[model samples]
Structure formats: C-alpha cells, structure tokens
Target chain A: MITIVAKSIVKEGKLETFKALAQEMVEKSRKEKGCITYQLYQDIHNDHVMTFIEEWEDMESVEAHQKTEHFEKNVPKMKALRHPSSEMTLYKKYI
Target chain B: MITIVAKSIVKEGKLETFKALAQEMVEKSRKEKGCITYQLYQDIHNDHVMTFIEEWEDMESVEAHQKTEHFEKNVPKMKALRHPSSEMTLYKKYI
Candidate 1:
C-alpha cells in the first residue's frame, strides 16, 4: 500500500477558500478505484495549517493521481492561495 | 481516533541519528495503551525528508504521549538534529 501526506499553509484570510477547494478535491479523490481513504484535517491550534491523508492501492495509482484532472486543476488554484510553501511525502506502508 | 503525521527535515548528515531516534520512538509508541499503529517513512526522492504517521485510540492518548518519558527524552534530541525548522500536525481522523 502507498500513503501520502500533504501539508500546506493557506494564505491568511483564505481559510474558507481553501476549505471549499479541499471539499471538492476530497470528494473526487475518494471515488477513485485505487483510493482506500482520503481525509482532510486542520490543526486545532493553527487553522492555517491543513493536511491531507491518503491511502492508495499502490505507487502506480498515486502517480496516476498526480495526473488526474481534479489534482492538476485544483492544485494550481489552491497553490495560489497557499503561502508559497508546501510539502508532500510518499510512503510505502511500513508498520 | 487521533492521527498524527510529523514531518521533519533532518539536519544535514544526521540521517542515522534521526533513524535511531525514530526506531526507539516507534517501538515504544506501539506498546502504549492507545496506539494502534506507528510508522516511519522516508521520501523516495529525498532522503532528507522523513515522516511519522501514528494512529491512536483518542485525543487523550495522543496528548498523554507528549508527556511520556520516551517522548520527552527523544523529542528534544530529535529536535536538535532537525533543521532549525520543521512541522507537526494533529489530525482527528475524518474520511
């Protein structure tokens, strides 16, 4: 299995904008064939920090996700609202 | 459940130190009462990027972890090995 954790800092004052986009992204991602789970979370202490937890069937599906229309389309727009900084990590499940 | 994904940039050349600390942390965490899973992953593309994904029974267990001796002992040392900068997120599991 493959897991991805994406963290981003939303530009101040754009919290609602980010959430709306995330809602769309999560809904679409959860319906994909290889997607096991897709979840969104925000820090209780820091609203600006948001994260996405994803589990996929394998690395191939994860790579394919990067090319999906939902990802390519919303990501650019979401990036615009971010703090010019973000990070992504891919993991091959290791218990 | 409370899930935590911790991302940290190891100080240059401190990969071994980080791994040793992580190994200790994961082993100890998995034995704790509420811990369901504790995992560590390194970026396939960048060795400097490392992440820890943890699942717990509840927020209380996660909060308790912060005060655990293993945590208090290793975290400071790990922090010292980290790039002066890093990030941590606490996720209330939502799918």
Candidate 2:
C-alpha cells in the first residue's frame, strides 16, 4: 500500500472554505477504486493545519486518482488557499 | 480515535540504527491496549525522513500509551538520534 501524508496550512480567513473543499474532495475520493482509507484531520495544536491521510492499494491506483475530476477540480482550489510551508509526503510502509 | 503523525529527520549516519530502534518500538506499541495501529514508514522522496503513524482508541488510551515501558525506554533514545526539524502532531478526525 502507498500512504500520503498531506499537511496543509490554510491561509488566514479561509478555514471554512478550505474545509468545505477538502470535505468534498475526501467524500469523492473515498469512492474511488483501490482506496483503502481517505480522511481529513485537524491538528490538535494548530487549528489552521489540516491533514489528509490517504491509503491506496498501490502506486497505479494513486496515479489514477490524480486523473479523476474531483482531484483536478478541488486540488487547485485548495492550493490557492494554502501557505508556503505546507508539505505533501509519500511514504512506503517500513518495519 | 487519536492519531499521531511523528515525522522525524534522522541524524546523518543513523538511518539503520534509527530504523532498528523504530521497529522495536512498533513491535511493542502494537501490543498496547487501545493501539489500533503503530507503524513506521520511510519517506519516498527523502531518505532521511521517517514517520511513525499511530492510532489509539481515545485520549485516555493515548495517555496510557505514553506511560508504557516501551515508550519510556525507547523514545528518548530515538530522540537523541533525531535532527532538529522533527515534529510530532496530534490529530482529531474531522470527517
């Protein structure tokens, strides 16, 4: 499985809109094939920081996910409201 | 559930040792009560970065986990081998 840890810092005054977009993306992403889990999380210590923890069956599935309409539409919108320090890291299970 | 995303940058020359210590912690943490998941993952884009993704039943369960023997023994040792940018974030499910 491949896991994605997307940590985003929402821009000031855009929390609500950012969340709405994220929730919509999450709901749609969960329905895609090979999706093991896809969920949104808020940092307990930093309210402006949101995380998307996603588990896909394989790299092929993840590639397919990028081509989906929801991804194409929402991701750019989300990025426009994000600050520069945000990070997206791909991970492979270890140990 | 409470999820912890621990992203640590291993010190130079400590990758193998860090992995060994992390694997031992994963093995023990998995046996703790209320531990839904305890895993180690290597960053696909950066060899120096390792992440520990942990899920527990609730706040109480997470508190209990901090007091476990494995935690007491290994965490500090692991920390010593970590670089300065390491972060540990607690998250609450938002959707």
Candidate 3:
C-alpha cells in the first residue's frame, strides 16, 4: 500500500468555499476503486493549512484517482483558491 | 480519535541509524495503552523525509505517550539526528 500526505494552504479568504467544494470531491474520491482512505483534515494549529491523508493500493491507483472526473473538476477549482505552497509526499510503510 | 502526521528530515547521513533506533520505539509505542497506530514511513521520492503516522484515543492518551519511557529515551537521540525542519500536525477526523 502507498500513503500520501498532501498539504495545501488556502487563499486568505476562501476557506469555506474550498471546503464546500471539497465535500463532493471527498465523497467521490472515497468511492473510487483502490482507494482505502481519502479524508480531509484541518491543521489543529493553523486553520488555513488543510491536508488530505490518503491511502491507495499502488501507483496505478493513484494515477487512476488523478484521472477521475471528480479530481479533474475539483482540482482546477482548488488550485485557483490556493497558494503555491502545496506539496505532497508519497511513502511506503517502513515499520 | 486524533491523528498526527509528523514530518522530520533526517540529518544528511543518519537515515540508517535513525531507522535502526526507531525500531524499538515503534514496537513500544504500538504497545502503549491507547495507541491505535504507531508506524513509520519513508518518503518514496525523498529518502531524507520520514513521517510518523499516529492515532490515539484522545488528547490525554497523546500526552501520556510523550511522557512514556520509550519516547523520552529515543526522542532526544532522534532530535539530535534530525534537521530543524521537523513539524508535527494534529488532526481530528473530518470525513
């Protein structure tokens, strides 16, 4: 299994709208095949630092997720509402 | 439950030692009373990036963990081997 830790800092005043739009994306992402977990999290110390903690079967699954209609539709919207500090790290179980 | 995503960059050449030292801590942490998950992961794209994905019953359980013998003994060593970029984020489920 592969795990992905994604962090994106939202624009100064678009938190609510970003989350509202994410609601649908999250639901759809969770239902995708090979997706084990697709959940959103808000940083306890910083409200603007939102994260997506995700798990998938493998690289193939991850690519599949990126090509989905939900991701296609929401990513553009999300990108427009976020700063450039977004980053994602993929990891494999070590212990 | 609370989930924690902790990122720590191992010092230039101490990755192997850090992982070896973490072996015992990971075992002991998983055996803690309220720990649901206490596992490690190495970033696939960047070997220097390591992440600890944790789950605990609540804030009290989390506090208890930091005070445990294993954490106390190992953290200082780990800190000495890590860069200053280490940051930990606490998150509550938001799916």
Order of the predicted models by lDDT, top scorer first? 2, 3, 1
Model 3 achieves a DockQ score of 0.82
Better of 2 and 3 by lDDT: 2
lDDT of each: 0.84, 0.93, 0.89
- DockQ leader: 2
lDDT of 1 by residue, A1-95 (tens): 87888888899899898889998999999988899999998776677888898899998888888889999999999989888678677876533
- Tell me the docking grade of candidate 1: medium
Name the runs in model 3 displaced over 4 angstroms. none
Number of backbone clashes in candidate 2: 0
RMSD (Å) of each candidate, 1 decimal: 2.1, 1.2, 1.2
- The model with the greater DockQ, 1 or 3, is 3
Q: Assign candidate 2 its CAPRI class.
A: high
Report the lDDT tens digits of candidate 1 across residue range B27-94.
99889989998898877667877888888898888888888999999999999999866777787643
Expressed as tens digits, the lDDT of each residue in B26-71 for candidate 3 is 8998999889999899999888888999999999999999999988
TM-score of structure candidate 2 = 0.95
- Model 2 lDDT tens row, A1-95: 99999999999999999999999999999999999999899998888999999999999999999999999999999999999899999999986
Looking at model 1, the pairs that clash are none
In the range A1-95, model 3's lDDT, one tens digit per residue, is 99999888899999998998788888998899999998898877778888898999999999999999989999989988989978889999988
Instruction: List residue ranges in candidate 1 displaced over 4 A.
Output: B93-95
